[model samples]
Target chain A: MELLCLEMDTVIRARPDPNLLYDERVLQSLLTIEERFLPQCSYFKCVQKDIQPFMRRMVATWMLEVCEEQKCEEEVFPLAMNYLDRFLAVVPTRKCNLQLLGAVCMFLASKLKETRPLTAEKLCIYTDNSIKPQELLEWELVVLGKLKWNLAAVTPNDFIEHIMRKLPLPKEKLALIRKHVQTFIALCATDFNFAMYPPSMIATGSFGAAICGLQLDNGDQSLWGDNLTDLLAKITNTEVDCLKACQEQIERVLVSSLREGRRQQQQQQQEQAGPRSKALDELDQSSTPTDVRDIDL
Target chain B: MCRTMSINLSKRILTALSNGPTRRNLFGPVDREQLQLEYQDSLRKDLEDASRRWGFDFLTETPLEGGDFQWEGISGTKVPALYRSCMVGAVEVLRPRGASGLGSAAAQSGKENIPRTPNRDSLKPQSLEKTPEKTQSNNQSNKLKRKQTNITDFYQAKRRVVATPRKSGQ
Candidate 1:
């Protein structure tokens, strides 16, 4: 058995090929299915027990952090949230199970979207090992059943490239917009307020916000056009007024969240500093002569 | 390669049979989602039975996203049913080994075949000493291709390879 267990180090960990992003047919099909799979009502609006909007926010934020730490592709987190929202819409899940649900959704989403799926062991460790591999596997089946095994629901990231295709920006600015769009999408995933809008609308709003964030010089008359809002709306098949409202909502949420995150960081830093400083003072004041030995000499 | 080709062949057949206005109209006025539901419902038993026999948890693992199975070298097909069934069928037909024994046996067979291919030097008993050196060189080349670069460069490089056809008058 030992002889048979040969170590092969010739494997290549290829970065996911960018060509996958350009599959128009697959992307279009995903878009259609996503529209079909969207929940007709928000989770809060629906009559569900034990699950609330804040619980979703906490779980989503946790999922976002895990995905970022792991350096997963941009699609993984949003797709996981899609699974989470869809499952919550159809099934009544306990608040206690929300984190488990998040983990399983990510496990399933990564398998679908990533070249290497997040393994059960790694996911268990992420949850502080509170959920066992077997339990995660069991719930994986349950979530899949609830989703009716449709895991490729359209995500805002899906629309990023499509929208980028239409936007008239230089390569560098385009890259910035893409980054901003991704951040906006992740931010949307964390807030239940954004769920009411369709994925396409959210994508358009995010794109609009991303462009605004870039503050790209609109001097290129041919590309910038007189009215950016209408162009974005038309591209996504959304109404201009509705697109504006969504974009504003996204900006508002993004601003508040950014402030909130900074505030939390500051508080954390102060709290950490306070405890360490007090410990240092205690150490300085204590005399080293007081020694107690419990051993039987 | 053969595993992938056969999967692709079967998928192509399934899609060519099911796609287009004529086939879509056969189910007349049924919404796409409902039709998909019927398709999965009809195949659930077969899928479950295959899983039970093969001892593979396809029900949980497969994302059921789309049927391309492009990772398996199949494309242009939208039938998850055909792709999965052909995979199970291929596994069953190629290796008659018992379920528990199949994992290692298949792995061993794959490893054994790799050296026996056109790469003849790998098979010579004396060449065993040189194998690690050869694999090391191969690893270096693979690493070169897998170098980490900024996303902007990668995206630009990809865009150059395949200029996305622009929509007219967008």
Candidate 2:
């Protein structure tokens, strides 16, 4: 008898449990405890003397690219960023050690969330071998200490299901909507501006942005503009004005990020094509499909 | 030849530009010595804070004076080996909660190791730190678990007495 075993490489995922998703208490507890995981303050304004917001963006971008390239669990990237933000909020880290911190955060988050957690050696390689595996391991303790070992952070990804289940999304489009929302959550994580916002707010705003961007709202009056904002604000219990502002800010970040990703793509294409071969294919590039990139929320 | 040269040049340019996975260093070269000093310094600070909060000097393995909780000492043998604070004397590092029991697991002979193989180097330093992931130790590896005497394990109804019980019942 012949046996088939071609699918061994696929990640085995548990179906979303009805027990957790269907329970209102689960959502309430998430909302209640989510604030505990938020960074105590915006570190740039107070705690960190050396690290700037742009530097954060840079490290965050690098970290995102690594996670994407590695095909890490979707929550892994945002959770890692949560660790990074929480660590930076309390510790006065120097500029040189920022990447190390980023690596440590990924190490901790991946371990917390993945079945096959990223090994310390591989993470070190992603840092261009700037750090040794031993150093990564060593600083893991330091990062843990700084975080007070609160590794199970309530990330925006945690809120996606509870919020989406309540929204009037079409059943068929759920998969695509989820993908876009997850992408937005990862994007929000990379931007330091969204670091302090509660995970639920980010999740709700991402949902609003996803529905609006896809023009899903045109079908139903409940999902249109102010109505949509009111619905979303009610789902997450966010202030209406605050939710409106958050959703709009999320849209702006998406636009700028797309522009940045486009510019970077063009530059890379031009440089790769070299000066002699072709005219700057500016028009050709924009017509290309939107590739959700390192910063493309 | 010219095309090949352009491709090589572009490849080099991209590598220099830090695109894809060529993996450029973010903040430039780190001072290894300085990093070590800072790591030690931060761990020290963490230890100090933990000591104050828990009212236990993790380094000295003793309770501090005028603290929130009273201190008591127990011989390592009485408790389950997993909770023993000073099972192995050579390693003393600062973890806010001295789950030294875990670090001691690394030092213990193979007869009693946790089912998971912790990296010795990793466990060496965090001798005091709690390994938050050890929750599965209780459910797995019955052979490694050092089975204890539960009442049901040994106390069961007697099957029969050979003498006259069956005949008498009849």
Candidate 3:
């Protein structure tokens, strides 16, 4: 049996330029590569159109929930996004298992960004033990290798922070704006156009778009008058179609939450009445018979 | 001629890996030795570059029979044992300076200075300074004092730690 060990010297030579910035051309090439690789297999086809939209939203929501639950930093999200992008870019679709892909991305991101990382076993348990710990570990290495260990991608959060500094908003308002934009990021998976936008561009565009949506909804158009409008327009083209698509996705997620709340309420109401009605029905049926016979005897 | 031959060989290997169909067979036994040598050469170059960037010599020397020892590469100096001891002493003296800088900085700031104490009370709405004006002013003052104390304690502790060893020896 021939054993292969990577030469450490070659490994060092393979180390990517840490300061290499992702240009628009590089970004486009990555997106094109992903498109080519995805439809190559059955598994890739499974997440192609409508199914992909929901999966993307679910993965995004799960990432946020996991971050919040573990008290992990928000930096983990961008790292996760980068991992997801790179994995999708390189690993052909046929080999893709979205569940494993999501878990692996989260695992890699957590390791990169968290000061103290959650172990594979702990993450498995957190994901309801659906994915085995060993599988996650293996997939992490696979994802890392496919990415060529290049982890220097500009993320959406970087863009948002820059815009927030420039925006004349209080900390709380800035946070609110961030939240609104993040809600839109969940829809980024739906469009291949998202792959073309730099993370910073996406973030700035989404934020400015969300602010305008809120202003219009509140019937305060003047709130985002000339200067902010000109600035946002310059940062992002701010097309009506794109903005509406983002807003609709955000509304869909919010509406889904509202529906879930209503469903829970209805379930609770049914549960509360279920036993009482059963007892009442039993009482009505047995009211006049067996007890009287026993007493007479 | 040897250097040229090696460079040519490396280029051929790289091209084979990147574009040639013979990549799977490129790392055969014959090529393995060549690859190993090339790798070592690359590592030596990297280490030399790192040493220069860091402004330190990593090579150590040994005493020879005739009161002379050979030194490796640039910045060659003898007195190996003395150099090692001095480095250890320098690190020991520097550590307390770093700790005291952090400690005094925390103390000089009006905020509670207890390290690693997770203050749950601060999470309460009532304890938080909600007004932007007051919070900004408080943070500014704390930062100013913290900076002043950090510089002062760093030098003071460095002197103390270094002086203590000398005094004990005396």
Candidate 4:
């Protein structure tokens, strides 16, 4: 059935009207907007080839920070991403203000998923007051209309929770597993390629495969590899691509951060010496005012 | 022979009656007598079922007066009165099999048949009497007037709220 669906989708893509190309253009424009607005976080310099994984790491770190600060559920982040993806699917790029769009998506998802909802004003303030409260509210309506009032979204949290329920691991190992899964999520955001994959697949495949890979790398290859192979067979190509992109981005960001850390250290040392040396040179020049004093004598 | 033909014709008439009316007049007065009869019959069946399920005697006494109903403790505590009332109302509306059979017999003999024309007129609103042209113009005018008010209020409220904070802060 999945193969049939894929075949149908391919056929639909192959025979499309000129007007249908608008969706592709819109997708490209949105991607461009994301690239321009969010960019590769400072970690891009270290691991250039595997930037997506680093991006996911950044996102996971940010999500943890936000969730902890607001006392909101961690699930809200993935829910927000789901809304953003579905909204992007339908709403034409030209009709949206991307910044407002992003913020509104987050705001709506927070309201939908979180047990305790944040007020529109609070969310606006949280975004550094970049947008007015009224504007945020207005964007909320615009977003709802554009997405035709679709509020339900399956999130990475749901996928992770389901997978965890099925796994036969102890609580301590499960906790470690969850942490790795979240880390993979942060890495996912760095990769442009990951945007095309459905959010659930991205979450499940990355975490599931990462756990398997981690186990294998640590020399516990026998059991996990078989389990992972079965898991991978069930996953779609799109999901695998997304996982690969996320992994690549993560590796890239790690490498980039390492380089950035070194560069920062060098810059700090130079910065410390720069002012002192200038002051000493000035003192030397002043003490050499003896030539002028001798001439005066 | 003439008597036999009349009997055959009456038999055909009875068959037609058995089929009932295909289309009902909507605007006429509701058949209250029929409704009441249906409700009573349903109440009786429900009481019977309740008695049977509880291993109690349904026909023995006046059940409405609240004797020690046998099912009271067996069904995990006594049923709430409001829930009982709701269930009774639903059964009344639904008109179960035995209830419908008894009620229809009463309805066939009842004298009050609501006129079809009155029912039709009552079903449609008097506003629909307007000429199609006038109705279209009136709808368009109403829509335009409503649109103006909505847009004005929407913009004014938005501006007022947003402006107040910046003006005070500045």
The model with the greatest DockQ is 2
Candidate 1, B31-94: lDDT as tens digits: 3353345335635755675565555557565433443342243552344433445455554553
Q: How do the candidates rank by DockQ, highest first?
A: 2, 1, 3, 4
Q: Candidates' lDDT values, in order? A: 0.63, 0.76, 0.48, 0.46
Interface RMSDs of all predictions? Answer: 23.5, 10.8, 27.5, 40.5
Estimate the lDDT of model 1. Answer: 0.63
- Fnat of candidate 2 is 0.30
Off-target runs (Cα >4 Å) in candidate 3 are: A1-60, A89-97, A130-132, A170-172, A179-198, A209-222, A225-230, A236-249, A260-297, B1-170
Interface RMSD of 2: 10.8
Give the alpha carbon lDDT tens digit for every residue of B1-170 in model 4.
Answer: 33343233223222222212212221223234543453355456556756655557657733344445533323412443334434555445544433444334334433112111222332244422432334334545676687776767989999999999999999
Q: In model 3, what is the error at residue A190, expressed in angstroms?
A: 9.4
lDDT (tens digit, per residue) of candidate 3 on A225-261: 4555556544434454454454444444334343343
Q: How would you order the candidates by lDDT, starting with the best?
A: 2, 1, 3, 4
Clash count in backbone of candidate 2: 0
Model 4 alpha-carbon drift over 4 Å, by segment: A1-68, A89-96, A168-170, A208-227, A232-297, B1-170
Clashing pairs in 2: none
Off by over 4 Å in 1: A1-33, A221-226, A272-297, B1-170
What TM-score should be assigned to candidate 4?
0.40
Q: In candidate 2, which residue ranges exceed 4 Å CA deviation?
A: A1-10, A269-297, B1-18, B85-170
Report the TM-score measured on chain A for model 4: 0.57
TM-score: which is higher, 2 or 3? 2
Candidate 3 positional error at B4, Å: 70
In model 3, how large is the Cα lDDT of residue A145?
59
